[model samples]
Target: MKRYLMTPGPTPIPPEVSLALAKPIIHHRTDEFKKLFDETIKLLKSVMQTKNDVVIFSSSGSGAMEAAVSNLIGESQKAITINAGKFGERWTKLVKAFGGVPVELKYEYGDYAKAEDIQKAIEKNPDIKAVYIQASETSTATAHPIDEIGLMLKEKYPEIVFVVDGITAYGAIDVKTDRWNIDIGITGSQKALMLPPGLSIISISQKAKTIIKQNSNKYFYFDILGEIGAYGKFTPPVGLIFGLKESVSIILNEGLGNVFKRHSLLAKATREAAKAIGLKLLSKRPVDSLTAIVMPDGINSSDVIKQMKELGVEVSNGQGHLKGKIIRIAHLGYFFKPDIIVGISALEIALKQLGVEFNFGEATTKAMEIFSDE
Candidate 1:
């Protein structure tokens, strides 16, 4: 069966990236790998829209997330967490795990934390050390307004570090790290970087570096400073790093503006198609990365996802409490207009097969029209 993946992550690696991964491995201490590693860092810096030090790790994005908490905030510090979804709540968990206090500013599943909420949460507690948020919450399929929130935090509370989880937002969306005053930004390779899983790329501001220097956490594995000093000299997943090099090369050749434009257009088309098919969106404020559609009144999202997989098209089911209510269709990374068409087409058929349809071909036709206009 021919498979087309509409899942958010481990999205789909391009043929060129796959071939690059297949190349013969080389010693990490070699000059050749060092050069490739340096060039990869340069491209990553451009894509992140920051001048800070970009560090690559051998773990998933969550590793970097934990690093943010452990390295920035001390064991006794009280941090303000914006808990809007599963991933947002992760900050709270990480804080607790590291013996820190969490002053959580929470919102409902579909809703996002507002600027006022963040301001109030931080202002009400003067002892808050850092404000943690996710730029894009994958579980809720919502993109938080990090730029606006970051600006607000910097203006009102420059002393508190603003940490962001950019796992799903980094490459697909415009994350001007320096411009936004984000102290620490984290992302993984699989999501929008178009590489396979197992690599997490992070960028840290000088301010965050200073704080980390003071913390003196005994983290030898996820140590950002150590990783920076020993980046190219170690055998740190050289294959995936090579894949990341090709992945970053492709992203740069396409240009950042064009990349954003492509994701925006495709996401818009996906949302429109789902709306045309009479599916309700799970997120009140959806983003250009993925669209999470609410299943009809009594329908099970798990059933839908299962059927799509059986049909050789795979999409992700909702996370945590939304497992049976919503299905996500991702438009990030290496996908294009044609892939969107394939996804909506499969979804329409799957809906019809599950006896929950209103029209066939309508969604696909509309998506094609939208793509043609672009």
Candidate 2:
């Protein structure tokens, strides 16, 4: 049976991008690869919506996150971290791992971070050096108010660096990195770039570069400054770089505005369909990238996931303590309206097979209506 990937990360890759990945590899140190790398960086800035310097890493998105933390914050320096979900909590761990003190602003899993909360934290600790947050929390399918927080920081704390993990937001959501005053914006190739896992991209502003120059962080491989100035510091992932070029070309060809609208429509259709089937949404502030639905009482999300897999559909289960309680269906990357319809159809069948009581056909019908109007 053919499988459908509807997970948040490692999302479905486009055929064109897959083909690009299969192309003959080139030596990273040569002029040909350097030209491709430079073109890819330019395309990356367009997608990131930033005029800042961008760098590509051969590691996962978490590697860029670590680079942001380790390069910007020094030992004994204080920073603010938002912990609204699994990825949000990563900021806290990274800060602690790098010997920086983290003033964690914790929120409920499905909730979003408020600008006021961050402002309050900064007011309480005026010595904070940086603020780390996620543009979209993948685990909870929630989106934080990065614009509000960034603008607030721009007005109040001009010296403090603003780092955002836009791993799930970059291509799916319109995150105006430069306009939002995000000093460092990070994303992964797998989430919204319509490519396989292997590359991570980060946009660094001039302010962030200056901060890194002043800091004495003890990191060699994650050195952001060294990665700048012409070519990457180490041997780059040549195949993934070629794939990224194709992926960004596809995104640009579709136009970023249309890409975001397509994602929004798919997410809305999915959310409406879930509600029509009597399911509750997990995220209070849902993102366009994915929809997280709370499983019915006494229904295990793992079982639902298993049933969907048996039907050749793949969705993700909640992480950490919420596992087996919530199901996350992704509409990001290469997904379209028909994908959502098929996913909802499979979900309806799975729920019925599990003996859950709900209107069987209404979900698909509602989703079709939304897609028709789109």
Best by lDDT: 2
- Could you give me the TM-score of model 1 versus the true structure? 0.97
lDDT of 1 by residue, 32-107 (tens): 9889889889888988999999898888889999888887777788999989899999999999998899999888
- Assess every candidate by TM-score: 0.97, 0.99
lDDT of 1: 0.88
Q: Candidate 1: give the clashing pairs.
A: none
Candidate 2 structure quality by residue, lDDT tens digits, 175-284: 99999999999999999998889888889999999989988889988878888855645888899989999999999999999999999999999999999989999999
Residue 221 of model 1: what lDDT? 76
lDDT values of the candidates?
Answer: 0.88, 0.93
Candidate 2 backbone collisions, by pair: none
TM-score computed on alpha carbons, candidate 2: 0.99
